[model samples]
Target: MRVLSIIVLLLTTGLTSCWPTSVSFNDTGSLHACLKHFQMDPLENSAPNAPINYPIELTEAIKSGIQNNTRLLLSGENTKPQVTITGKITNYVVSPIALQEGDNAAQNRLTVSATMDIYFDCPNDNYTHEMKVVSTRFADYNSSQDISSIESQLLSEINTQIVQDVINQILSNW
Candidate 1:
């Protein structure tokens, strides 16, 4: 019995002592950390999903980005970059976390989760991988007027996160 117990402990210790393992194939954080560690850029300014497969929330986010920012190049019939970012919302929700009928604590939680699948069309063709990441945040308002404020800030932040995840995948795998 003592020998068996000792062997079990030894084996368990060995396994636990091993360095942290890689993140899931769908985890974007792992992908980003891996890329940032190497100080490499992972994007080619291409939209991976030409026929974008984002959820309604993501679509709204994209629209908002295009409207407010002049940096995103509009995709046309013959404008494709070397790499593209493809992502979809796996989860999106907004709920009131605390309500006091006033600005005291009436807060809403906004959360969005998405996974990115990056593919290289040129330079290194036939490279593809997927990453999943989630983001959540909170906002407070006393009336519906706050909707615009929250959407402008929280929604955009979440959208940025989703895009960054895709970018991370491209960078890390390269």
Candidate 2:
């Protein structure tokens, strides 16, 4: 019995010592720590005759999204050259997606597209890349549901999707 107990204790110690191996992936924090600063510029409204004129709120949402993201740290006070992201809301269109009767629209889809320029300031060199992101949401013309409420929800979703895309683009390099 003493021999068995000793063997079990040795085996348990060996197993525990070999557990929890250090595993590191490409998304480690140390890898991203160098490019920590993320400066967001004012989002430009380039859409001529846009359906909605909520540029301030839209811009604020994008800024908040980038600041709140875990991958990148917001650099509002830094005056040095950092990662600057400039965006332009190019299109906001609501079109008929389906028809119920003759010339009657049953479903409508709202699509929002934005252009982003990601400028990276490295120690050796600086470069910029352009990425276009889009998001779409649909609404059904039902009498039971309020049209304005449906549109408001769709718009909110569109903004979120676009912001998520921007974050993905920023993180894709790492």
Task: Provide TM-scores for the models.
Answer: 0.40, 0.70
Residues 46-117 of candidate 1 have per-residue lDDT tens digits of 323212333555655543443343223434456554334455545555656666755444566665555545
List where candidate 2 sits over 4 angstroms from the true fold: 1-19, 23-31, 51-53, 124-149
- The TM-score that candidate 1 achieves is 0.40
TM-score of 2: 0.70
Best-matching candidate per lDDT:
2
For model 2, how does the per-residue alpha-carbon lDDT over 1-174 read when each residue is reduced to its tens digit?
999999999999999999987876545642244576777777777776444555666777777887787456677554554577777777776667666778677666666667777777666444444444553333335544555677667767777877787777666764
Model 2, C-alpha of 67: deviation from truth (Å): 2.0
| CA lDDT of each prediction against the hidden true structure | 0.46, 0.66
State in Å the error of residue 119, model 2.
Answer: 0.9
Error of 2 at 20 (Å): 3.5
lDDT of 2 at 130: 44
Best by TM-score: 2
